[model samples]
Target: MAGIQDHFKRDANGNVYEVDFKYVRNHVPLNWFFEHMLDAKPKPMSGAIRYGVCPNEPACQAASVHSVKVCVKEDSWKCFSCGEHGDVVAAAAFYWRITHREAGLELMRADVDMLKHYIPPKPETAIERDDSALALVLQKVAEASPYPSKDALAYLGGRGISERVAREACERGILITIPNDAFQAKAFLTEVAGKELMERAGLWKPDKKAPACAFRPLWFRSQSHCAAEFRLMREPRDGEKKAMRYGGKSPWIWEGQTPDDYMLVEGPIDCLSAVEMGSKRTIFALPGCENWEPNWFQMMAEKNVLMALDPDKPGYAAVEKLKPVLEAFEAMVGIFNPPNRIGDLNDQLKAMRGLI
Candidate 1:
């Protein structure tokens, strides 16, 4: 039998070269071990994989009792009976009784059909951005839209943004309020950007005729006008469920110029609040807490980043995920939860102005 021992002995020392588990798993098919090493057949299932009895007959005798399912497409498996579940490297480790690292290295060196060189999957082609369309839409909104109405200004005043600042923001094309009249909003969008361009820009759903700008405050990203974010300022009507915030197709990132120092906040509103409160440091505002991009680290390399995300679970979790990436780029990262036991930067601004 071509067992594990015939191939190699276990390493007692921690001197083996580390191999990427993802790379090994990507190259090695799960069923190859069953067919080549254990000489067991895996019956094909209706999906992208096959299932058979568990191969670890000696340990649990699960093979005779339940099915061992293998998803060849994902290079993963689960033996429902024995409760054994893992990816390709985990499968190898389970069979050989070695560490996952050891199995990964072994699979890398094995003479089976596994590729000697790991070829990463080609990245999905990026769609070319229609900057002209975005610019035209923003320009039309600024020129023709009768936005930031008295009610909109009052909404900003309620949020602690001074009337003067709100007017200035609107004039600067940063603050735009859509009409509460859905028909007027849809007509304005269709006349300004056309329905086809709106759909392509992700400002309108194909199945729905209503533009995303209806009855919402649209905040254009300070850095690039390529994207706009919408937030509902009122409660949902009866039986109407709606997300609090959403955006156009493009992701938005606020650009800043303060070298080696910046503040990161969630949402353009928070960014506006911080700036309106006389925050001097450059601010990089994401569209939302969950919208942080890995590529953002490139800009923060060797920089001092102060994160003022929402003071909630998802905010802290995003900070956690971002800290390591920023640290890897040699950036000094610090955290700032909303002070006074508040929820977010905007809320803090409200508290400062005695609105909360």
Candidate 2:
């Protein structure tokens, strides 16, 4: 890791934000940083990490090489034969084409590297990425109208949701508040990303589509009111009334920036509840019961995660499916059963607060 000292700077608004690259890099575990080294499976260490032949070195994977010692329990690996082994920083430096020092520096100064002229990612160069037009429209709408409206707030509060949670829900796209006039949403989007792209993004609802909207020709308007399908306030089948269906890549909403521990809860609202009650550094909101992504496990590989999915059938099934996957990483997996099948963590919290 970069051994440089931490430095701080103040923004125009006098808000002090952390710019301590070396310090942040030091905190990230070496195994986690160099996880790419474990990409190849010499032999599946089911529920454990074993020292075997090196996958990175082709000569090692084939035979008589007991040179690799992988401490799955410790999240570390070593190849004595080739003398190539280390934590995430060393592993990243080793594999990366650039100089070892450069790779370490890049990892440490990640935030500063994102500046336009600071690094690659030019039009015809380093990085390539794709974006869904529909998703873009949603992003644009979110950027413009981030805060929840009075109606949105009241609607959630009426449904036993708190004001703080209602605000978070709107900001994260878990819930949306759109103008009553459909044209307002369209015109607002058109003004943002222009007409041609918006039309091509499939704003007009086709009759044959899953949700089956009659006329949703405009982009922003269609997503005027939507909610992620997390069963928080009540059962998903009964409680969730929003028919707004969208498809694309969505990540778990995290209020707390740290990735150390995750209090995996069913609904984003439940996550909010956990955060509001001071579990802010340790909880993450799962989008739905069976909505985990493959990369999510690796993302939380080092975390001490707690699964608090609803105790209902679907929720239980989700937990069963995920338990083994996490256990494979040697994670301490625990099931949190809300009393009497009353529902998620939020429900229990609300009951305790006498808000229910």
Candidate 3:
């Protein structure tokens, strides 16, 4: 960390000016600045600071608190949930909503060695992971628990999903069901996923040997099938609170080819509903409000985007945060709501079919 008093030189009239960009960028301790400025918590082991509140999605409830992390070594910050990342100067600009030059000046003025309380901790030992093996195991799990099973079809029917759409989703391998019988699921995974792979892939808990999704029967896979969200068929029992188990980062669930316009929805069900409703625009479904990726901006650049997220607090908040981000990438942004003030796209499908 640079000393606070050395960077600025006083003129005859006491006007302070910054020395250079290198001094502000390299000499300042980013961790200390984030700690003092954003009230972030330092994770010494990771050599990063977790933002106390993510500036991108301040009101978001789905993503865990402090989901945005700033790497001390790189002096860069990234919000994992919103996919917003930039350097220390950009961080200041985003937080204060100011120009880059103004942010640089602010950094220069606040230049101080505050490393007394912070020590850069060494990185943790690298874990030898076989991602290919994990993908293969998940594929086997999906194969073992095929979609359109009795319970899954029933669940889809109750949700007002057309049989045709459900069949198409099954063909795409986007949806599957784990065996309702825990013993049966365990036996199958023990052979297919194996104990070592499951543990290493974080598909199994450290204390428990069985697959994490053993009891979670409803499975929703990403388009690439690299990640999955395991959902419970029924409400969680006593002493169990979580209704979903997410494995790996969620990928965008894409539908339609290269269309000029794109419609963004909350989940796969809504995506299917859009297709069933005869929507011609390309559809990209995020696993949830917090899962939008930054790289998607490139694909959506100079294109029209419609946000059809759920008509709820979290949904609206996410849109409010994401709309500007898309716009910044030169994507035209619009908001879509269900007709007759229905809940979501799925509810709209139910209304369109007189199933509500």
Give the 10-residue window scoring lowest on summed lDDT in candidate 3.
60-69
Q: How large an RMSD does model 2 have?
A: 20.5
User: Candidate 2's residue-wise lDDT over 1-356, tens digit each?
Assistant: 13333444447996544444344345544433333334433332323444443423443342243323433334345553343555545555555555555555555554442322332111212111123665565566667777765654554565456788667666556554544334664465567655544444444332322221112211212222322231122222421222323443343555465556677776455666676556655566665666666656665675777788776545777788888888777777766654554657767766766777
The per-model lDDT (C-alpha) reads 0.63, 0.50, 0.68
Q: lDDT, candidate 1, residue 92?
A: 77
Model 2: lDDT of residue 121: 14
Evaluation by lDDT, superior candidate among 1 and 2: 1
On a 0 to 1 TM-score scale, where does candidate 1 land against the true structure?
Answer: 0.56
Clashes of each: 0, 5, 0
Report the CA-based lDDT of candidate 2 relative to the real structure. 0.50
TM-score of each: 0.56, 0.48, 0.60
Each candidate: RMSD:
12.6, 20.5, 7.4
Model 3 vs. true fold: TM: 0.60
lDDT of 2 at 179: 43
Model 1 per-residue lDDT tens digits across residues 255-301: 34566687888877787787777766667787666666677667788
Please list the residue runs of candidate 1 whose C-alpha ends up more than 4 Å from where it truly belongs after superposition: 1-135, 145-147, 171-173, 205-209, 221-224, 238-259, 337-339
RMSD of 1: 12.6
